[model samples]
Target chain A: MQASMSCRPKWGICKMNQDLIQYLLRLGDSALIQGQRLCEWCGRAPALEEELALMNVGLDLVGQARNWLEYAAELANDGRDADHLAFRRDERAYRNLLLVEQPNGDFAVTVLKQFFYDAWHLAVLEGLTHSSDSRLQGIAAKAVKEVTYHLRRSSEWVERLGDGTEESHQRMLAAIPQLWRFTVELSDSDAVEQRLHAAGLIGDPQQIAAAWQQQVERTFDSATLPLPAPACHFYLSGRQGLHSEHLGLLLAEMQFLPRAYPDATW
Target chain B: MQPGDLIASDLGARAAAPGDLDQAWQVLGRVMDPEVPVVSVVELGIVRALAWDAGHLHVVVTPTYSGCPATEVIEADIRQALEDAGFRAPQLERQLHPAWTTDWITSTGRERLLAYGIAPPLGSANKRSLLGDNGSVNCPQCGSAHTELLSQFGSTACKALYRCCDCREPFDYFKCI
Candidate 1:
């Protein structure tokens, strides 16, 4: 919901307690899955500095995931802690965007994926900073710094790959169509978003979508990449626990230990 | 006063009276990391030195990473802890170099980290970075030399994902500086 200048502590508490676990999960899973994708480049980056830089971005996303997941756990209020929410979720239960879970095909593809997500995420985070809910506002304030850097890093790579050699340009161009179909879901306002918006836990999806489109167009212009034609929405329905095929394998790898040794603590 | 004499006086004064440093260490150790309540500031290796000089407590803190968000919260916690310990307000300064290293982690701290479900740093002997060409990192839990790095970054910037072959657990090892 859009933040108003009027201060009502009662509303803040009530609004903060809104059940937006699905919405928060969307944020958390996007970062968590994308962090996994970025980690694929750990020791294999084309350049050493670039390796550190890429890992840096990956770390930021993982940290962001932890923050959002913790909040999501609170929002769920079913005694699920952040660890439980993150590690115990089934493949179908993950609420990440389709683009984030896509395999990191190549450096160009990874950059394109990041550019798209960062543009949307940064705008969303910026909007959240004014939330009537203090916790979300606090989290957003901290995340904005990290997301800003992430945007800068991805933007630079987009430019380099788009304007570099012919091969790189072609690769960058190809990566766009591969990921562009998934962008539509980012703007799709559904029940969870509606609840969050009414409670002032989040901004209107339309506003975020408009800002995202402008930023995306500007970045594409700079990168010399063209926007893909509009297509049917590629929805994964991660909020309702429906997901693509990739999440199962990811969960298998991530949740193996905890599931195998149930209730085991260090 | 000669520079060396000033340094010696400072060192002599330090040796004669432990000052607020020992007290500060004890008090600050009680300050938990805001995000990870299980970890203390000392365990995080953020509080590098606690000195009592000019009738005030000086705490030199090195951030976990260049842009770690917890620094401000940690600093506030440190000040509050010291104030609670009877110093009106402590003087805090941040030091960035010889940057804080996971190598500085105490043995007890390492054990705590493992118990907390995050892997401890590989010993200095086993630690290497991409900045260098040595690919040796050990699993802190099992002492298995057969560990592979899963990710250069982990849940946080200060960590790396590592999988131990012997124990077969993927963990976030606090990365070496």
Candidate 2:
């Protein structure tokens, strides 16, 4: 049965594999981009403790990215490995959410971005734990534990900044409008996710979105920040490879080393 | 069948001779975690299983953290240790399911962590810790229950920075994830 499936590339099996690979890329690329953005705060964070926290969270994301990318490469059955998929791909080929690739504007902006992403991340990972794909289940199970801690930390920061001093509150207020539009991609799903979900290999988009919305609203209420109207009309879709200008710049710096030294190795 | 089941069946293809599995376990026991040299990987519960496959020793290991920098180093160390102990090119498999948790750390491992001045994970990693309520971590140095969390993240991904109020000393607490 396994041999027959492998030999038949034109069958539904190939199509399912392709969709699975795309979904994996979405998961992997989001983590890689988000981790890179967090690492940008390494030397410039406000305090020593904050610096460690940012880097630590960043490390976890990057690590998770590798796991997803490695699985994607295996299913791809192409010559490209995880490193090649991560560094060699151009901006349009990347599948990370726009929220992660956005530039780290300010402390308030970063915190809000993280808070929103963490909520969605936890929901998606928890759903993935029950996936029919055993490899994905394992990966998601591991990530859920780490992301649980991440969500707690980021949500606490949202509450702290939103309800703290006057300036802090104002900064968070400004951040809401700036980043809220990008979150449309979080709840939005396309054909790839639909196919995977139908195959029982991924989570239901509506359920994951509902859980995400509940958590975000709860946190915002506690933080005393008004829940902005849903920016559903926004059409930015990172999974479809439509990215903002910021992603190209970020990728330039990130891919420079590998691109410049294609043959270099440790 | 599940992928794990496939691995299990393959492992059953050739059972290890008596004492081979025991010898491999002993070799792995001597192989310590690179980040925390005091505790062996076996003690840390990262080494999940040892089996024989196709006349070669197969070892399965799980990383403590997803992006733990030490995972590669630890794998290499395990391979080197097994090879040095006369196991030929032992196969190393990285398993991600049944994720590594602090609870896996044996009682002896917890003692080693304490003696090394790192407070063991406080309590069971339950749903409560996921909700921003990590139970109080006691100080490893003075055995003080008055330790305060200095930072959610410490020197490593698996640790949180903490300070003992009584002794006024800062230390790392193995986070209960």
Candidate 3:
């Protein structure tokens, strides 16, 4: 897989190590997309407290995204900064998970989506803390603390919404299938991950998958929601630049100012 | 010397210093946190270390939170303070390893935070607390241990909104992270 042409520098050339760039994009784009999704709740969350919480979490994720993207930009060394990578890239160039790009349905759906992502995120960060790459280890070490809070908050919400009222529980139950199919991608590792794992730059896929499953099961037990069968077949794979229709729309809104003005700055 | 100055001096001795590094520490000790203006960045423990390399002062900093809006301001403020103190174009390095924790906030910083009406983080940033076992936060206003968390987040990423059961006053608790 070659580097996305759009990600190439304006001199019509790319001098990046393809595998490293791809790996960094996977880390950064996931955080960026997920952060943007959370920020969409700014003025619309159920209560003031929830609003603040959502935005705070969003801020953390975006900050982490900047860190990862900054490193990616450095590695690319292709005349693009983190902002350029974030705003200028086309939808097909993004490497975020399909789950994060999904719409924030109702509050229940949003919470469940966050819970699922947080579980996987914590597992990945915990693993990355032990990475052979010191830079990744440092980023992961810092992020693990923040994601721990995120997971705790989301998992508690899962229990609350799942066991709270007939309406809330039913809503949580309904949200399951709308989001569960995406879980397949959480544990699915392709060659990029396999190569990184072999080099000890990343965690073992089997261990990460096991940790993610254990976390989901523990939270599901507490939430009193029965676990559904894992989705076996899903052609969706965001890492390969295959995204749903939702991502293009999201990029249209998120990239509007930067794309329009080109030279805008605060 | 003030208690804050004492703590800063103690930390200053940790590094085998030239006169410049010690002076830099003194200068940073007066550079207050932008968000929590009552405490200096040194008191907050974000100024991780200071050194001189190739005729340039090198200061290492860590953000209190990953998404802290105040990080850039704090970095700029540190540079400005160093420059104002006669160091030419001091370099700032952001270190992410051994991630910043509330446990790093100094005792004097905690006292200043209480005096400023925000409760300092209770206990340590331990594994149990990270698992959501939040300890009791005492009211900074009335010195009562009876306080309830109004929200997990507050006006800033580093704080949680809390209301004192005794005085019925709402205050910010610096979250343990």
Candidate 4:
């Protein structure tokens, strides 16, 4: 059976040779959806400074999404631009991690989610900077800088809330356990990643996960939060466009303006 | 003039004077960034390449800030400015490789940023960003080194909010990346 033009491959198996495009979409969708989540906080963040910071970070990820998606469009050769790829796809076509799509439950939740994601982002990008693919290397190099700053900000918040007060600490503690399960899929390699890993175009998933583990352990230790045991049953498949129930609702809202008024320029 | 000489002369006349490349740079210099309004894109090192190709002018630009809101508008502005300066249908190619960095901002760009109340980056983006390194960043307002970070982000995506303790003036520090 032929894969649809818009939808990427199913998890653990992609028969098509369009590996680079698939890889790019994996990277792109995560950033794009993450950015969208942050945009949800545009006017609603706890403080004015936090509002500006979240929006800026959202813009950064969206920008990176544009970069990756633009390149993916070229590889896909389906005449779809970044806008179409972002706003026209169904949730089944989305390749973002489930961790990103999870609701921003509270400030504690946002901080924990961001800290976890940032560590992985920085580690993966750092490894990708040495990729045989020049485009991947360049994008990774540039992103490393941005995500470094992101990790710092989020981790500081993690520490602040963890060590702050009874309420803040309790909230952070509650936020971690629920979100920890989703991180398992982060570095769980599929056939696509395996092939790319062999070619030296993508980072080693194990190594990247290890780096993130070190960072997470350190942050949790400092935050005075207990590290939850890694999930025994990993929900192992967001990379192949398999996502949580949250994604469909997200795509509905994100695609609204574009779907309602086709070719709407904003 | 010989036939080849004639072709060259006609193309040159159509493009601009022999020094029109210089004139093109001048035109670029005058086109201020919409957001900052003080520094031109050329000064900021976003305009990477400018030349005549196949009897047409081609301008290559690397948009600064990965998802900077101003990327497209700035590109449009560049195209419009070049057309207004008589370089008709000049090609504009937006390249993304090696991504834009704060290090690319020229000394002139730094001065313009300072004058515009935005502090320039202290050093290279990579070095300043390594796990722990908050280098000395003197305030653009009062040239004070005693500045505190109010927020990681400022008025724009490329800046951080900083308040100068000495002058007590809040300012924007253009982030290294």
Candidate 5:
């Protein structure tokens, strides 16, 4: 990481290439974490259609994560596959944004969190399509299409929940502030992100932030829900592997069978 | 479960190979989709590639839908089929880029799908407009273009619930992405 510290002015290609694994992890971790959270609702969603939809969204994220982590493993050249990258890591080693790993509280909370994440996901993925790295470009080109549908579904739910009923409105409003702070860390670029930007491996997070804000505001207006106050000290950035207590519990469950069974394939 | 082979140490090394890809493809052709038993994975176009690496057979597979539950089952079936056909350990690589769109569904695959009572996806994946969910869909049961989507989601992740006007029967519409 010391080599990575010397990044800002002009990043060393070798060092930036090394940081590429971490960059991929940051992206992959978010998807993997969200997928794990959503997969928990496989049989528990309120309705059958909703259940399949939730599981599908989770699957899409996991699929994206598998692509990213597989690429990351290739970049690291360490021979580990995506599954190892996903289930083998400890909780503290994960680099997902704080937003995704937040527990799926109520149905409203889950939908709102997804909407928030998808909003940022779209902004970032669209910019990523033009990455100088052909691998990133290809993945982004494929992923942007998937996330577009994801955002549409989540945004529709936000609108219905926010405008539908007294209970649904309150639940949606309550979940907004609960998860809003996590969105701040999404656009806040860290050192690794800066290096990837310098290398043209990824897009500028600032532009993504601007797009995310515009889209979120438009969505909130239609949802009839007031956006929460901006930036309190609750900045929970999971980028550097720091995460909430909830992550550990989630990991314990997901990694259990994998860790126990090791190389066992289905 | 034997954890030693699955451990991460030599995990990156290519699996042992026989390079028997022709036999592997033949085996794969017989591995049907778990949900739709009539159609094989190859027909579904999910098995993207078969190659030899590190003396082990490597396969590239892309599921029809990202959230399709049968992804795991299909992979297992492919592995088991190849292994049963006397190949050594086969490696499966999942690629999401150039994501699997309905366009990848082969013409033969489309026929198999239609015969299976699920309407096939109508449009190409490239022209994906967000809200255009209501395109004219032919009912597989009646071959009627007059079909109404009852729900955007079906019993499984990759389908939509629809009812046909001509046949007055509820069926699954393999949605165009």
Candidate 6:
């Protein structure tokens, strides 16, 4: 099948290489959206240490986004660089998972969101460590160390919340049900996955799902929160350009300067 | 030789030779933090070593804090600046040892930050001496040592947000670690 029109070559633009850019954006946007959500807790966290740790995780994710977006721009063969790709894209152009765009409800919800995503992120990064794409592999290798710490920190919080005060325990337990629906989407399969998997740029989502389930199950068990049933068909269109209403608002705030003043520099 | 002439003659070879230190320091001052983009990494104390090795310039930098987001971009900007100035591919060596401390932020950087409207970090000695073991950071703007830490985490992980009683300006304090 021919590449989509959005992926096609345009006047004054280099040869279209949308698949690679889209794939790279998928990674960058995931980190970007999740990092924004994490940043919301900057001034408000359960405790001082926890606050720093969460902020560190957010920084790591945004750092990862910068690296991946830079590579995406390079692959696009367009003159656009990391800043342009990150700040110039329309809402419909982003391919981040819907779960990342979900607002941070509370401390417990925030930890749950992080725990859910970190578990999947580490698994995917581990797989991508040996990708055929050199740039992707290098970024994943550098990010794996950071994400490992993220997983450890979030997992500790999960257990602490699960075993903490009665109020904390109940709040954390309630967070699980609302957050579980998002996990199904993380390992959801799609045509893009098929192409990338064939190209050896990604691993099988089914395998990733199986591994992620085992990992999260053990962490939840330690957290004392029972695993909730997965949604059969969670928000599935995010990777294909469809997203929740919150995503556009996020892009607007994130891309405001670039949109307002084109080619503006620091 | 007289005492002064003997001292000068002996010091001529021993004096630290002025190399690209001045130029590198100036260029680094222009290289801002990749994420924040307001503060210079040199002022942030992330630049460890700047030397002229053979014909190429070598710069060694460590992260401001462990896994700080600006390290990668800082390295990139360093390379870009040197190349733009007609230097060869600059050698950027990563050194994790002697981890960066907010205490190392040059006085110039602190002044620049204040002039830019963002409060500078309290000197490490002042904070360590004042807070005892609790590690309280005083506000830079109002000289109000009585400040409460809003979050151990600031807008970014490398900083902590504190509010002052005198001015009530919420500012990001560069964490000592």
True contacts kept of each: 0.06, 0.89, 0.80, 0.69, 0.45, 0.20
**Sliding window of 10 residues with minimal summed lDDT for model 5 chain B:** B1-10
lDDT of 5 at A247: 92
How well is each residue in A94-176 modelled by candidate 4, as lDDT tens digits?
Answer: 88888999998999998888888898888888888899988888887777778888898898999999989999999998998
Model 4 chain B weakest 10-residue run by lDDT: B1-10
Query: Which tens-of-lDDT digit does each residue in B66-164 have in candidate 4?
Result: 878998899889877776666766678988777788788889999989988898887776745534375867899789899898998898888889899
Per-residue accuracy of model 3 over B1-177 as CA lDDT, tens digit each:
323334334444332335677788988999999889999999999999988876567899999887889999999999777765666667789998878999999999999999999999878897678775866888999999888988888998888899999999999989888
- In candidate 1, how many Å is residue A191 off? 2.7
RMSD to truth, every model: 14.2, 5.5, 6.4, 4.8, 6.1, 11.3
In candidate 4, which residue ranges exceed 4 Å CA deviation?
A: A1-16, A234-236, B1-19, B130-132
Where model 5 places Cα greater than 4 Å from the true spot, the runs are A1-11, A77-81, A232-235, A258-266, B1-31, B47-61, B66-97, B143-150, B164-168
User: Candidate 2, which segments miss by more than 4 Å at Cα?
Assistant: A1-10, B1-18, B132-134
lDDT tens digits, residue span A1-266, model 2? 56346748677888888888999999999999999999999899999999999999999999999999999999887778999999999999999999999989999999999999999999899889999989999999999999999999999999999999999999999999889999988777888888898899888988988988999899999999999887774556798898999999999999999999997899
Consecutive 10-residue window with the lowest summed lDDT within model 4 chain A: A8-17
TM-score of each: 0.61, 0.93, 0.91, 0.91, 0.81, 0.64
DockQ of each: 0.06, 0.70, 0.64, 0.59, 0.35, 0.12
Leading candidate by TM-score? 2
Decoy 6 TM-score against native: 0.64
The stretch of ten residues in a row with the least summed lDDT in candidate 1 chain A is A1-10
Instruction: Please list the C-alpha lDDT of all candidates, in the order they appear.
Output: 0.73, 0.89, 0.87, 0.83, 0.80, 0.72
lDDT of 1 by residue, A1-266 (tens): 32222325567554545446667888888888888878889899887656876777877777778778887777656677888987898887788887788778888998889988898898898888878777677667656656765776688789989989999999998898777777876666687687788877788888998888888888788888887655465545655666778778877887899989988987
A163 Cα displacement, candidate 6 (Å): 2.3
Model 6, A1-266: lDDT tens per residue?
A: 23345545572232324555777888898998899888888789878767777777888798788778888887765677888777887878888888889888888889888988888888888878778877677677667656665776678778989988999999998887766766667767776676777778876778878878887889888877777776567445678878878888888887888888987876
TM-score of 5: 0.81
Residue-level lDDT of model 2, residues B1-177, one tens digit each, is 323334444444332343599988998999998888999999999999998887678899999999999999999999877766666667899998898888899899999999999999867777686564766788989988998888899889898899999999999998887
Deviating ranges (above 4 Å) for candidate 3: A1-17, B1-18
Question: Given candidate 6, what's the lDDT at residue B90?
Answer: 66
